[model samples]
Target: MNREILVENLIEFLPILYKKFFKGLDVCEITKQQFELLYCVGQWDEKPMTYYCSKMLVSKSNLSIIADRLIEEGFLERNTLPEDRRVILLRLSEKGRGFLCDQTNKFKKEIINKLEKFDENDIKRLNEIMQEAREIVTKLD
Candidate 1:
């Protein structure tokens, strides 16, 4: 297949996959944007709000609102850098970790249930393909 067609297929399929995994998801009580922010903090460790603004593609004001809400909800906390009081660091709290773990397990269970109909060979092939895709994506960084 042409690279353009392959890229197009990925673009098209990714949203379908996202919807399958995230649509109507109720494992967490947060909005999609909020969940994404939590996931980013959980995965990336301490980072500034600007970092998340870049990652989440939102304005500082918008992310601040999201961050404020998350902070209020006890999912995330901000710490002023001791060196520079102007710099703020964001990280997930224990509650946030628990929430992430619960949501992950829920997603895992849902995926496993969906995969039950597939044969072992098909599942193995899919795992191999997914790993290859992950490697390819990692190389883009």
Candidate 2:
């Protein structure tokens, strides 16, 4: 199979690892969608709604709906910049942060455990390939 197909398959499974491995307690279970979105937005301490829409390749209206749901669930908050009240910014809530910390730790452990099976050369090649992919994506953007 081509490398892109392999990457696509891996992308599909990354989110499932959270539900199947990182079990959340009570009503806090992170839906695959929520986890994916939070994974992107959490990178920015605070970011505009437009930023998320563009980054996730979703329509603005769709992003707005998801953002609203996240805010209602206490996972994220919508705030307006003092200088730009017309636009909104997204930030994760305390709940979101706590959840992400656990998720990140679980994700790291799982990933490292798998990667550790590979020799150092394989790990180095993976990093190099990933960096090349990032550079290609940057140019495309």
lDDT winner: 1
Best by TM-score: 1
CA lDDT, every model vs. true structure? 0.87, 0.78
lDDT of 2 by residue, 21-103 (tens): 45542234656667767877789758888888887888888888788788888889889999979889889899888878888
Residue 34 lDDT, candidate 1, scale 0-100: 92
The reply for model 2, stretches above 4 Å from the true place, is 1-28
Can you give the lDDT of residue 115 in candidate 2?
65
Alpha-carbon TM-score of each model against the true structure:
0.87, 0.73
State the number of backbone clashes in model 2.
0
Candidate 1 TM-score, true structure as reference: 0.87
Worst 10 residues of 1 by lDDT: 20-29
lDDT per residue, candidate 1, 15-90, as tens digits?
A: 9987866666665578889988998998897998888888889998899888899999999999988988887789
Candidate 1 lDDT score relative to the true structure: 0.87
